[model samples]
Target: MKRYLLSLRLFWTTALSAQLEYRFNFLIELIAMLGTLLGSVFILSLFFSHGNKIGDWTWEAALVVQGVYTLLDGITNTFLKPNLSEIVNYVREGTLDFVLLKPIDSQFWLSTRTISPSGLPEICLGFSLIIWSSNRVSNGIHFDHIAIFIISLFCAIIILYSFWFLIASTTIWFVKTWNATEVLRAVLASGRYPVAAYPPSLRLFFTLVLPVAFLTTVPAQMILGNINLLKLFTSLLFSIIFFNLSRYFWKFALRFYTSASS
Candidate 1:
């Protein structure tokens, strides 16, 4: 474990050095991201100006949900978005053969192929929002709630990564599978708010079929003391099942591969 972590650190160092070569571009991108975040905060402010509660969530709770959404966004940008997109290109150009020949786990290599340090500011902003909201909550938060929220959020991240991987791996069989990732981005957008805010049918769809419930709502609700044991267990169950399924499916996809040289 230590050796793997050391090697991973080395990979991060190399990636960071490469990205720093374009320091001006990196700064510009960072500024643009900050502007987008401010816009999102402004919209949320208008939302809360109308009412204290939206579907049993107080304004602070809602803010926490938005923070979770930000964290999810940062995660997608930092890892999944760039690498998963490349996975499709690898398939289309038949360059995945180069990835397969690497000595390490291909998925791990693929996942860490690029790192977006710019996303770290967004992640920090997300945590800062959570802390601000928790401080303002009338009932106050307990350590247990925070602990559960951490676990639940980790599960949500795993579930989301697996779901995206499931979609991306389809490229092994269907070369055009890359475009489907845009649809995934749309679906995950629904997770920006509490799932309960949607109509009953949409709520059921997000909760059961797509996992937006586990992705955003459950973690925020857990932090706010609004979640139950069943919700926690179900989130864990979904994450474990999907993570295993994506792993196995990745192996399944490899069976269909043919080299670019062919």
Candidate 2:
């Protein structure tokens, strides 16, 4: 564990150094992120223009959901995209062989090999939105609620990473799974709004099939002090199950891996 931590530090330090060389990109990313956030909020406001609450969620409460989604999106840009998206390139170029031959765990190496600091602004803005909007809500924010939100958000991240890695792992067999990942991202975009805002059928599908509810809604609900123990337990259970599935799936995929020599 100590060795792994040391390696992670080394990996990220190198990645950060490289990213710093392109510091100007940070301003571009920040502007784009702000525009996206404003657009999302604008679209959401269209729903409440006539004083219509979406699935009974008020504007402030719904903003919490948007905040959660933004936070997750920032995480994807920072970690998941930079890391997992390269799996196809690794497989196609037979570089995964080098990854597997390393002294460290391949999954960890692949997932934590780089950092994208451009997403840092989005992550900060996400927390700011959550805090700002939650203060205007009826329940408001409390220390306990913040604690629960942290735990819920952590579980959400696990579920998301597992889902992404699960899809990316398929590159072992399908070396060009870019479209598959894109489809997954499209489905995940639904998470930017509260799941309850959807129709019953879509809500059921997102909850049971894609589990988008756990990704954003559950965490937002926790922050809003609508603590549902059952849903929390379910979220935790799903995170564990999904993470294990990703781990084991990667191992299974490796069984068919053939290096460049082969």
Candidate 3:
């Protein structure tokens, strides 16, 4: 674990240096990320302009969900999304063999090799939103709720990475799995709002089948003191299941990878 951490730090240090060399592109990407984060907030604000609240959430609670989505989305951009896209490119270009031969874990290398240092600005932006939203709530933040929210957020991240892994791993079977990632991005947009904001059928589909409810909804709800035990347990259960299944599927997928043989 220590070695992996050290290697990861070294990798990021190198990646950061590389991005710094491309100052023009780096700045453009940073500005783009900033615009995207603020755009989500703008949309949320527009929604609240029409009414006092969204579903069971007050405007403040809805903002919290937006903040959570922004944070998680930054994380996904920094880690899973880029890696999955790179993996697809590797498959298409017949370069995946190089990754398999690397000294580090293939998953770790694939995940961290392409760090988006530009997304750091967006992550800070998201953290600011969460703090700003927290201040607006009348109910004082509870230490216990904070703890639970942290745990829920952790599980949410796991579920998200697992979902991405499932899509990326499909390349072992279907070399052209670019459409899968596109579909995932479209599906994940639903998490930007309160799941209840959608109809009962859509909400049930997200909550039970897709698990997006756990990603942006449950964590913000937990922080708002609105999380039920059942929801907490459900998120935890699905996260564990998805996390394990993704890892297992990765291994399964590797069996079909002909690599250089192909």
Candidate 4:
């Protein structure tokens, strides 16, 4: 465990140095990220202005959902996406062999090799929105509600990580997992709205199957003090199941990874 922690520190140190060396490019990327986020919120507001509420959710609730979604998305993009994305290239170019040769956990190393400090701005913006929205509520939020929101947020991240890991592991067979990642992104983006806004089938899929409901809606609901113990347990179960499945798939993929140069 200590050795793994050391490797993670080394990895971050190298990544930070590399990012510093390209500070100008990093700044440009950060600007682009902020633009995209603002653009998304603007579009949503425009749509909401056309109609009072989308389904049963008010504009304020929608904004809260968007804020939470953005924060979680920032976290994923900052850490997991930047690193897990390289899995396809590693498998295709035989670089994975070098990773495997290391005495540490290959999955851990592969998943943490890169970090995006540029994502901090988006995370900050999202957090600000969340706080602002919480204060905007007519009735104030309680400590217990805040605790549940935090727990739900943590569980949401785990669900997202497991889902992405499962999709990225497909690279071992598909060799072109980029499209898969795109599909996952599109599907996960739907979590920005209340799942109740979707059709029955879609809601069921998000809640029980893909489990994107736990990503943003559940956390938002927790803040609203609408969460039930049963649902929380269900989310926990889904996280554990998906995480184990992803780990198993990654191991299974290893057996089939014939280095590209081999």
For candidate 2, list the clashing residue pairs, or say none.
none
- lDDT score, candidate 2, position 248: 99
Which residue pairs collide in model 3, if any? none
Worst 10 residues of 3 by lDDT: 117-126
What value does the lDDT take at residue 115 in candidate 4?
91
- Each model's lDDT comes to 0.84, 0.87, 0.82, 0.83
- Tell me how candidate 2 scores on lDDT: 0.87
lDDT of 1 at 75: 82
- The residue pairs that clash in candidate 1, if any, are none
Off by over 4 Å in 2: 22-51
Per-residue accuracy of model 3 over 1-262 as CA lDDT, tens digit each: 9988888899878877888998898888878877876776688678668757778787777888888888888888787676668887777777878888877777777767767754565577767877678767845778888889898999999999888888888988788888888899889988988898999999999988899999999999888777688888888888999988987888788888887455
Give each model's clash number: 0, 0, 0, 0
Off by over 4 Å in 4: 47-51
Runs of candidate 3 with Cα error greater than 4 angstroms are 260-262
Better of 1 and 2 by lDDT: 2
lDDT of 1 at 200: 93
Candidate 3 to truth, TM = 0.92
Query: Candidate 2 versus the native: TM-score?
Result: 0.92
lDDT at 170 for candidate 1?
A: 88
